[model samples]
Target: MSRKTLNLDSTLYDYLISQSLRETPIQSRLREETAALGGPAGMQVSPEQGQFLAFLASLIGAKRVVEVGTFTGYSALSVALALPADGRITCCDVSADWTAIAQRYWEQAGVAGKIELRLAPALETLDALVSEEGVDKVDMAFIDADKERYDGYYEACLTLVRPGGLIAIDNVLWGGAVADPANKSADTEAIRALNAKLKEDRRVDLSLLPIGDGLTLCRKR
Candidate 1:
């Protein structure tokens, strides 16, 4: 057996999905609709990533969740499905156009009642959460918004999530640009800086996994 993570080519990746993924019909249709939007569709998490988020929430017995990005609502839907009937998730997003698409799919999925869509600047939404909910009130949080503001999201999530709760940050690798010193774009550098900080941050225990453009999981201590 290999000691390190295996590089998955497309064929192997498809095989892996065939063997392990359990996407529902609504999820698949949502994916297809998002894909039809062309380049912007890439912002949606892959099916496996959505499943993993669900698994994490279920594993933690999470009932209260927060999402910093709700693009078309795939991830939110996934997690909502795993929560108990009384559970809820507050989704932060500014795009009415995009989240409207998300709202339709969420309604169809029958998880609409479980999700609250906040259409405003994400930071404003997050800060308001801290004020309204107080610290340590959230069970889990997912961050997948603007790369430049990831640190802000992470900090807010750190405060919101209870001790031992998790904060899952998406696109931590920024398409592998964080490792390339020459690729010093603003988004890339912001992600790179967060990666470095997370590695040493004493407030949480971290793991940077090589899943879905790199997902960083921080369990608040």
Candidate 2:
């Protein structure tokens, strides 16, 4: 009798996947390899979340996207697959190691030409985009980098993304830690602050969706 979002238990979640997920072989291989990495593999976006991002990108007709974190490139690949042939995404990540794995999978998926990997601090890369390309031209931007710098990334993306463009932020709920005042970890605090700020922010249309670890999708207005 609940009217709100369903609280998905394992059985329900399995049923949901059984009904809706349409992961390709390339995506499955990427997920399996990422899972083999043990605990760190948890950073990879859930397969359904990847599908949702592709849908969102397609909805907005995204041709130029900026990704703040690439990690093994699952999210980037998912969106890249949805984009047209000439579409491009600038992927920012500090790790050459992880991005090498990403590069391999991206090439395997035939989306390598659509993605440009920048092995530098994401803030630096974002700032360069604003400086070199000017503002209000990016179709979309996804922020999933260092939590403390989320506000910085958001502001940079705010400047870079065109009006009505989308900025999708990952882990806004921080695994339910944002609502609990006791968890004062730096990352938790950062996400909490950003969530509150987004609520009051007049510049965008915001929705905090219960997808994956919690995705905050903001459309610049």
Worst 10 residues of 2 by lDDT: 96-105
The candidate scoring highest on TM-score is 1
Q: For candidate 2, give the lDDT.
A: 0.94
TM-scores, each model vs. reference: 0.99, 0.98
1-221 per-residue lDDT for model 1 (tens digits): 99999999999999999999999999999999999999999999999999999999999999999999998999999999999999999999999999999999899989999999999999999999999999999999999999999999999999999999999999998888999999989999999999999999999999999999999999999
Task: Give stretches of model 2 more than 4 Å off.
Answer: none
Clashing pairs in 2: none
lDDT of 1: 0.96
Highest lDDT against the true fold, candidate = 1
**Over the stretch 100-175, how does candidate 2's per-residue lDDT look in tens digits?**
9899989989999999999999999999999989999899999988899999999999999999999999999999
The clash count for each model shown is 0, 0
After best superposition, candidate 1 residue 130: deviation in angstroms? 1.0
TM-score of model 2 (CA atoms):
0.98
* C-alpha lDDT score of every prediction, in listed order: 0.96, 0.94
